[model samples]
Target: MAKDRYAPKTLDDLMANMSSRMSSYVGKSQQLNQHQELLTQCVGATMAQKCRISNYRDSILVIEAESAAVAMRLNYMKMSILSDLRKNGLADLCQIKIQTSPRAAADQQAQKKRSEPIHNSRILSQQTADALLEVAEHAPASLKTKLEKLAALSKKNK
Candidate 1:
């Protein structure tokens, strides 16, 4: 008996069909990748690392920079970047846009947090607790609560 043509196929078969359908898109994707690499090379390592090609469409390349300062700097290099892209055969790359994105800043903050040594909730030493208790007597009520908490933490640990 012949298999039903409209029936769903195995995962591999489905993926293969989808891949074939997307073949045309692959060329444009490669061109975009090339444009990004070329842009990086033209701009130099330091600035390029902070900027990335966010979109490419209709002769415009939208670049996302880490901050407004970087975006402004890239804006100044817009013409130079366009000339370099044109030279490399991407003549359609006529306009360059620089946009400040908070994503990079957030990622940097997250990375810093990850790399930082975590502070363990420390129990105060007996000597330190005694000192806090002594100081708390003369301390204003506002400071007393904090000192008492530390003294209590030290006692609990004993």
Candidate 2:
């Protein structure tokens, strides 16, 4: 029988062949890392801390922000960031896209803590109900309607 020359004969040979086959993927990963490093340098440490380069595709650099407010702020810096990327040899970078991701775990937990409803009580005293009604009388029409509803609900609870 003829020797199967293409078949790897050892684990090291197989690993070498596999790495060669994956070279393109490794190169692409390196390019992505370079782009991310460039972006971080361009945007500076503070702004970069709030966002990351999520992808670069079809000449667009997609950035992921921690929140919509941060995205908005990044949007304002899009042009400058693009220019900086080009200057740093990322001439293919033509546009900047800022996408908002959900808050990180710590930020979400802090928000939850801040928004937690008071557990003391939902019940309202007669005096508090009367106070709401009195405030409603002096409030603007729009606010008055809402306050009146609250006062009515408070009275019903009592």
Candidate 3:
């Protein structure tokens, strides 16, 4: 019997094969993430959410802000941020660069849209309102009053 050349391989096997080729890229990504987290901690949650670490090279740290206002704010804190980074393990970091990127704002907006819950304003059907009224008649006084209010509100929607 001949071996199948097009057999499916396990994910682990594929990852193991690719690990050597991707190791440096993965390491660099992790380092950047760590730097980003450190920056967030230094700047506070609100400011951090508006900017991101774009790159770090030759002792220069590049940051991309969602807008010019954010970039200006980052520039104001550059010295403090630089010292903080140095104290936190990035001792060789020499300069901080802030750039405004409109695309960052768009990306943030898209993320907000994805995270926000979609609300569908659905009107109650006559059948449901009638059922609610029927139940309200037998419910306790407090619940009956609430149920009656709900049924009445549903009718107003129509």
Per-residue lDDT tens digits of candidate 1, residues 36-79?
A: 79988899988887887878888888888999998989888888
lDDT of 2 by residue, 93-124 (tens): 77888898865635755878899985856687
The alpha-carbon deviation from the true structure for residue 26 of candidate 1, after best TM-score superposition, in angstroms, is 4.6
Candidate that would win on TM-score: 3
lDDT of 2: 0.84
- In candidate 1, stretches whose alpha carbon ends up further than 4 angstroms from where it belongs are 1-17, 20-28, 104-158
Could you tell me how far off, in angstroms, the CA of residue 3 lies in candidate 3 after the best superposition? 27
Model 3 lDDT tens row, 33-130: 99999999899999998999989999999999998999999999999999999999899999999999989889889999999999869888888889
User: How many steric clashes does model 1 contain?
Assistant: 0
**Candidate 1 local accuracy as lDDT?**
0.85
Candidate 3 accuracy as lDDT:
0.93
Report lDDT (CA) for all predictions: 0.85, 0.84, 0.93
